[model samples]
Target: MSTDKGQYFNDLRTIQANLPTEYSRTFGQMIVHYYLHLIKSSHTQKANAKGLKQQAAGILQEFKRKQSLRKDYPATDLLVWVAESNHLPQALPVTSLLKEKKYRVTYISNKQQLLANPALEGYNKIQVVLPKRGIIAEKQVKEFEAVVSSIIANTNLAIITAEDIDTISKAFREYVTYTRQLQADYEKVITNVNPKAALIGYDIPTEGRTLTDVLNAKSIPTFMIQHGAMAKVDGIFGTHISKTIFVYGEVSKQVLKDSGTKADIKITGAPYLDELMKKLHTAGSKAQGKLKVLVAFSGPGHLTTENHHKKSIEAVMEVAKNHSGSVEFYFKLHPKDNRSYYTAEMEGKNLTNVHFKLPHSQSNDIFDWALFADIMLTGASTVAIEAMLCRKPVISLDLTGDYKELSFVKEGAVKLISDKAELNTVIEQAVLQNFDAFDASSRKAELYAKQFYGPTDGQAAQRCAQLIEPSLN
Candidate 1:
């Protein structure tokens, strides 16, 4: 299982480094194709070449089917692009609210999860733009090669291997063909839809960048909505091509300003958080018992190595062991993490009080977990902010000093602990006493919410709708 996971992650890194970021989803599909080929090759006792050809043919057929479904539609007032199902919630509220005002809103995504989202059913249209698999024409291929060669010759990427170059070349060829096809399809849709403005969840990824580039070329206004907490201001939101960016709070807006980002910034808060706050306001408190400590695992991006994950889990288990029967630890896994990896790591040692929870299930929503947790612990997850919004004390473990600059620590929203001793002390204090009962911590939590997430009122969606209304008109 570890070998399988390692190979899988290595493939992911290769694809991520070589292909356009938007193709990350397509890379998963490619992995499925490869696995199918491997299984067939093993069953037939034959060379894998035949299976590879079969997989390619199958991908081509599906690509052609998706392409055949493309057709012209009437003009729309607004076009919203969402990359994943998780982004659907942020897009839904604004689109739904806009629909009431009679604006024609259309949604587009390459991900099936988003296309199948029930929340997007009320939109004017929902289109899925699947990536195509095939070689481009010889002339276009030559032109692409020449362009890449020039870039390689002049760029400072001095340590790339021949294998890396070959991988990048192949990936770039696919990206070029796929993006051109997408551009053609999107151009037709935009021309027929004739949307005055387009709204995207975030504009840093390759998909958003490519789509935004297309829309900007046609002089259509574009807006990027804040989908999550911004650890820093110099990323996608800061340097995106969108004319306007809708953030969740003044803090994010000010961060952009300090970073010298050239875009109109608006604080609409977060629609999902607004709704969660409403539920939290009415929901009953957790039943009193052993103090529940929730530890949120940062995703693969931050926990880059298995050792990092192992060490983090070890730290939490140590705390749980120290507290024994007095406190319980709930380990919340990141959505993108493989559950088996953590489960295998914790199979022995018998930490009886430690429990694992998956992300985004009925019982494990960050907000729900926050409500049940007396104190939340994490390295640098957005859950720190969510926990604070739920009135839970947050202990940010910065053992490696990676989280020192994060907004939660920098803004005094959480208790930052850099050493094991400090972590133990903080956890003991949190478990023994009502940490939220302290006036200073309560005030700090409130300030964190205000600075990080503008308002708790359930009008964030309406506010976003109002911002897009003028663009539609």
Candidate 2:
């Protein structure tokens, strides 16, 4: 359990590189992206290894279960969509536009639960297809198992299995077979459709990358749309693999450009942002409240390594207890976040004006609260950028001081504060509209919004569609 992150990441890469050649060539590319989220507050260096072993087992079991259930895909030329829930909003408008232009499109949702999500209601009709005639061959699984066992026995990768090697020796074996089978599913799907061009949102996720890599390997064009703002991280996130990556505007284009990315980065105004701006500009001013403050949580695992996720809420609510009548604080949880924990925390406090924004039925959801809030607080989340697009003042509690790469903060569109005192002072000023601070900040936010989101004419989806239409030719 070392604090040396450099050593930890190095060991991670070594384990990934040592994966069975077949998988290392495919799934290994994004293993770090997955592991970065796994190393939450409840992890240690030992726990990290144990977690990977368990993850491997789960994957293998899932694939083995699927061996009995195989289906064939539709045989036809098509347009493929690999957008998950997070990517749905950015994808829906553009996909809709393409369909309107008479293109054959099918959305292959990765998660079954997404079927119930309100966003996909009308766009849910999909091409239920598969080219494979049968389930996983027994020989494929056994061969992978043998290769992994042989490699683990022959290699120097104690870093991956050191914590509980004997108990989970089959872990690596399962992992290798799972990736192989997973890749084939994507390949078979692509073979069935022979897609004109496949589109996947911000392609660092292993599942998305697997699908796109399969397409890329087949020489089928692929597009990785800008799902959110860029963050500063080691290669754990935002490594593009698609034939082209569509960014929102100049700022994100520059961020990816400076990252030394090999993929072509093009400026395409965000599809979701276009709709939000349409709603925002047509909507009136924020509703009446004393000092309307929205504190949004970016979930517990991603950037909350030291438990800053919980503490930030404590800091905000702790201070809110002081000015009961003058200010109201709204707590907005990320869609995947637990509601019970925050509900309990606010239960017996007897605090006034503290409320939780429940999930919205609208596709992108948080636009209502983002519009309602006069000021916002968060840590290294794209929510800050969305709030900036709404021209709301944003404050981030950089408790660790390592979030300097947060885009809005870097551009001076958001205020960066270190602790509770500053949070209180900023909230007070934001409430009083001290010397046109709100007006001045609003103007600054809009100027930068043009840079962050490009044209507000609501033509982003058209622009994106035009760029993607060429691949069909």
**Tens digits of lDDT, candidate 2, 403-461:** 66656666667677778887777777666665243454566667777788776688887
The TM-score leader among the candidates is 2
Angstrom error at residue 342, model 1: 1.6
Worst 10 residues of 1 by lDDT: 1-10
lDDT of 1 by residue, 1-473 (tens): 11122232233333334544554433322332322232222222322344777888777867764664576666789998888555777888788888888888888776666777677676666555555544667675565455445544544442333334444445544455555565666666677778989998666555666677678889899988875667554333334567888888888787777655678989888887756776677543544778888888675442234455566666767777788878888888876656676566567667778777633565756777877777788876778887877777778776666565566677777877776777777777766664643445556876877788887788888998898888888
Q: Name model 2 segments beyond 4 Å from true.
A: 1-23, 27-30, 37-70, 76-78, 116-174, 231-234, 282-287, 358-364, 433-443
Error of 1 at 380 (Å): 1.7
Q: Native-vs-model 1 lDDT? A: 0.66
